[model samples]
Target: CWLQQALRATDNPVIDAAVRLGNVLGLPVLVYHGVREDYPYASDRLHHFILGASRDLAAGCRARGLACVQHVDRSGHRERGLVYRLGADAAALVLEDQPTFVARWQTERVAERIEIPVYAVNGACLVPPAVLGEGIGGRSGFLRRHEPGRAAWTVADDESTDIAPYDGTLPFVPDTLEGDLDALIAELDIDHSLPASAAFPAGRAAAETRLMRLIQDVLPGYATTRNDATRREGASGLSPYLHFGVLGPREVMRAVEKAAVGARHSIKFADELLGWREWFHYQARALAKPEQYDRVAGWARATLADHAGDPRSHLESLTAMLRGETRDESWNACQRQFLRFGWMHNNLRMYWGKRIIAMTPDPETAWATACYLNDRLSLDGRDPATYGNIAAMFGGSPGDTDRPVYGRLATRSDGSTRSRDGGAAWLAKAAS
Candidate 1:
């Protein structure tokens, strides 16, 4: 259905309640307010799809068949009945359900506001499980099923899924939306406190270039050198592209598999990527206890709460870790990489996250800090996978179970030293 949030009127009291609920729920509602000011455009300067309509979209709908019946502003009342009189063959509205229960009410309100079909797009996962299977029960079960299909990621290159050849009618391309990138940035009023990461150029061409570089130059050495962090270029920097939908997961899988020379190490690296990235969605969707935002895992709340008041030690450790000043050389190297590159290898990510929980007074704060930095600085921000990965770290496993690392929070009672070698040395050099 035609999606215009601003054009739709609601009882002011109801609007206030809806906003309150959205806040309580932590859901970022996506309503098509008028066309985005200084909207992103195609390389040739044509706007194809609205920005933030979905992941990986790099254009605006102002030039499309869509009409802007309303502008999102401080005055939030408008009539939808008259807007519909403007007409379209069909309308598809998109929204999100996240963090809180208040989102459900907003969804209903929007649905009533616009009489057309509302397609609630689940914009998080790489491959939506609904498309793959009718809701695979939960996290563990979904992972079990998805694990085998790791090799099945393929591209729709052969016109099998191509929409280009279909209708003789050319797609609507909005040229008026070609925007000044600087103006858009200034208008958004993002936090200038944290400097922006490297200029990972935005465009289909740039995305392609990065992808090819990952497959050819970086991925081959991924298994061996990924944890070093000093050589930031060793790991595939494809996370941002993949997260943004600039590059599809299936396309990545296909490319890597084709290039793999039956090297077990390469295969191992691929499996880790799939498990950590693809299967993470499965875990998040499945794990009921962890999925609940307020629900902390078994013993996590009590253990972390007990020490929450004394955060000085943990804060010092975290500060050192973030600044690449950690005693451990490998962790330091990873910190340096994160400082310079705004990312670290998957192996290092687990280590860093676990260390944060171990060193932090409360596990929740640790998780929150990781999420904050990840979202703010990294190119791949605001992703469920990232959050889910952080969530997994809050609850320690075999790899990070050893403790008294931070009092009663230690999962492993019988602690034994398992030496971590490679990462520290590599990172030390990088930071130095």
Candidate 2:
């Protein structure tokens, strides 16, 4: 089993599927997870989180009577064609069915080159995107197909390995992650400037703690307080864990179902988690290149392109934006969250995304800038949901009047965050 993003041991369809197939064949499932220094934004933040998760993943696999191996691609530890080397001994390969970013591209290449039957399992979403079928036009349509199937997919069948763990490997020796992970990370050739997130610590323990917090603190009044950026506990703050697959939607929702919260709050949280999030996953699966600028709504693209040459006075440099030093205080507040914690409030992100158009040279630049900042600074960046949310901000209902840089596309304001009680004080402190 070749694991990329899905780091969890339990409730992981990829691993479970591998184990089932292995049991059927009377063969042991050898799980492999590698971290390279070359992926975009391979910083201290992303590396630390990934390595931490991977360490726990190995331990978890061991507890489940499965052997898991890892490789940290750094100087002196570089292993060429590791996956291919490992694939040479396998009866069949199992991989994650990721739609966006590096995981998608890498999985495709591997499946094409390898001769064995490569099974790509959907470990990311509660209901597999493939089950929803192709060409889902919008979220409402997606929910129609998705909602009915949720109850069936919510239950996890964690498969047990029938045979002993795989010990026959001809490839290079795997690095032991349990010993000095921090020292191992320090040797890697990645961005050292972007430090690890102290707020959202890595590992299964941290993820479980966040889930408990969601049930206990956040879910009670989630319906009413989710929109408010001022309250520290308003948001569930589970995006980082969800992104890395440390906690699957199935496990999270299972906890949600048992939580002692009001039905309304639980339902609202489910809508955001399953309804909105999985919808983006489904949407991205249909697109040729979901990350590109062309994937945005045609009308919004046409209108923005039409006003590309319009004069703009609010433009800021890339460095200013990267460092969260922009003139706009509210946008800076949102950016600082990404800078400091590698995460941001969903409510603040809507405003931060929309404001980038006026703050950049052009629409294309705006899109690129928004992507760059988010993808570089945030843990949940490079996800389908991230682009989907940004796309929503860029192309929404056409306003009654065309604007300066933004043509017919509706604009957003900081008033949502700024107008609340003590909201101004929050913004001032957040930006600082």
Top candidate when judged by TM-score against the true structure = 2
lDDT tens per residue, model 1, 71-122: 3211232233332332232333444422112233345566677665454433
**For every model shown, what is its TM-score relative to the native structure?**
0.63, 0.99
For model 1 the TM-score comes to 0.63
The regions of model 2 sitting more than 4 angstroms off are none
lDDT of model 2, residue 162: 58
Worst 10 residues of 2 by lDDT: 161-170
For all candidates in order, the CA lDDT equals 0.46, 0.92
Q: Model 2: per-residue lDDT, tens digit, 73-184?
A: 9888889788998988789999999999999999999999998999999998999999988767788888899999998998867898659887874588787787877787
Which pairs clash in model 1? 1-91, 1-92, 2-91, 25-100, 138-286, 139-286, 329-424, 330-423, 330-424, 333-427
